[model samples]
Target: MKNLTDKEFEQVIFENQLLILKICSIYCESQADKDDLFQEIMINLWKGLRSYRGESKLSTWIYRVGLNTAISGFKKRKRSPFIQTEELPEHSIDPKLQANQNEEVKILYHAISMLKPIDKAIALLYLEERKYDEIAEIIGISEKNVSVRIVRLKKKLEQIITKQLGG
Candidate 1:
């Protein structure tokens, strides 16, 4: 595996920054922690670039690196604080639906925050709409396992959201 040139590295980061940030958000409660995780992920990506054989899609490679860093950092930190909900990126939302959607997003993230580290990584990749095969590759799980986990994760998330909503 060849190392990415500086230009190539910057381009890769430009293309995938949001994906990295989302992974960080899954493992981090505070904005400061998220920022720290993001930086760690970037550093790992730079250091690991030479080893990135093209066995998987580039996005899959990025997911693999991002998730491993997040999970490892989470274990090392052993953070137990509650999720600190952040506002979603600005987008045109119907005024009538904004409040409901915002609350739902917050609840959803809170539910996600309660997940174990691997489950959080799985949930993030699943929510990103990755194909089951791609998710299996990124997570290093069997495709069948990815399918089963998604089903169970959905149920778990539903239960968590319902409990949070007092339903």
Candidate 2:
């Protein structure tokens, strides 16, 4: 693949910024940490741009880089054992929806935060309505694995949410 010019890189970042932010938010608990992770993902995306072969959809490529960067940064940082019930990064939620569904959204993201790194990635992609094939591609897992994991993740998330709501 040809090198991405500064303009091209900027355009790509602009288009996918929300996706990256979502991944960062899922992997991080605080705005400061999310900002740090977003920068890391951006740097990795810029560095990896030349290596992108267009073998997958551009968004899929972004997801792979974003998730990899988030998970790597997550592993390097220390975290509190308890799940953070704080709101997700502001950019991660729609303000219109937030007005009506704020608490439920918080609970959902809180439940997601309890997931392991790989499982978190799967959950994020799944929730984004990504296809099984695209999710598998981004996750570097087989389609069957993606399907199986989605089933299990649903059950687990439901349990977490139920427990969190004290049901």
Candidate 3:
């Protein structure tokens, strides 16, 4: 696209920034690490915007690029132990957040913590309301595998939540 305006670019970032942040939080082991990862994803997004070919939805492209960036960032950070992360930035808790949903969200994070590295990516996409097909494409997995993993993950998440709450 020619003559892309700055406002349009900023709007795209504004709309999807939360999605990137959530993905990093769910995947990274430490708060500082997540923040660093988030920055990397944002930078990659900005850089990749120019290469947009309209082959897929903007969200889909972002998912692919952000995830690739996350994987690479994780690898880089693994090699560098000097980086220290602070507490993760807090999002506003919804005023209407129910007690059960609050507990579930917490336990969900716990479940996410227990997921394997790649599974964390799948879980993040699913949580963001992505279709299995889209997730499969983003992660280079078969659609069937994505479907199967989501089913298994749902059960696994429930078990973790149950165990955490002494159920």
Candidate 4:
């Protein structure tokens, strides 16, 4: 694959920015850390673009690269204590539903944060409604493995939420 021209690169990033942000949010707790992770993912995307072989969907390629960068960032930093923040910047939701949605979002993110990095990647893709085959493609796992991991992850998430609620 040839290098992406500046315009093509910009357009690709612009189109998939939300996908990157969602991945960052799943991996990073604080806004600053999220911002840093987002930048790293973009850099990796730019640097890896030439190697993209057009074998997978563009979004799938983005997911693979973005998740790998995030997983590496976590491994390298190994930070135990994250600076807690109120929330990621809010998006416009129906005013009446905002509070309810925000609380649910917080709980979901908290539960996801407890997962191992690779499991977190699986959970994120599952929640995004990606098919098992696609999830496998992104993570380089077999479809069967994706199914097994997702089932285990769902059970684990239930336990986490139950514990959170009980406490």
The residue pairs that clash in candidate 4, if any, are none
Candidate 1 worst ten-residue window by lDDT:
85-94
Q: Considering lDDT, which of the candidate structures 1 and 3 is the better prediction for this target?
A: 1
lDDT of 4 by residue, 1-167 (tens): 57878998999899899899899888887666777778779999998988889999999999999999998765465454663433434552234653566655777789999998899999999999999999988888899988988999999998888787775
The TM-scores, one per candidate, come to: 0.81, 0.82, 0.80, 0.80
Tell me how many clashing residue pairs each candidate has. Answer: 0, 0, 1, 0
Worst 10 residues of 4 by lDDT: 85-94
Could you tell me how far off, in angstroms, the CA of residue 152 lies in candidate 1 after the best superposition?
A: 0.7
Q: Give the TM-score of candidate 4.
A: 0.80
The residue ranges of model 3 lying beyond 4 angstroms of the native Cα positions read: 1-3, 81-101
Report how far off residue 47 is in candidate 2 (Å): 0.5
| Model 1 residue 154 CA deviation in Å | 0.3
Per residue, candidate 3 scores C-alpha lDDT tens digits across 1-167 of 44457888778878888888787777776656777787778788778788888888888898888888876667776677775554655663333553455776877887998988788888898888998888988899899999999999889888888999889
Q: What do the candidate models score in CA lDDT, each in turn?
A: 0.83, 0.85, 0.79, 0.83
What does candidate 2's lDDT look like per residue over 1-167, in tens digits?
58878998999899899899889888888676777777779999999999899898889999988988887755564464653434446675465754676776899999998999999999999999999999988888899999999999999999989988889
Top lDDT: which candidate number? 2
Model 3 RMSD in Å is 3.9
User: lDDT (0-100) at residue 122 of candidate 3?
Assistant: 89
**Model 1 lDDT tens row, 24-143:** 777887666776677779988999888888888888998998888887655565454754434543442244653565877889999999998889988998899999999998888899
Candidate 4 positional error at 65, Å: 0.6
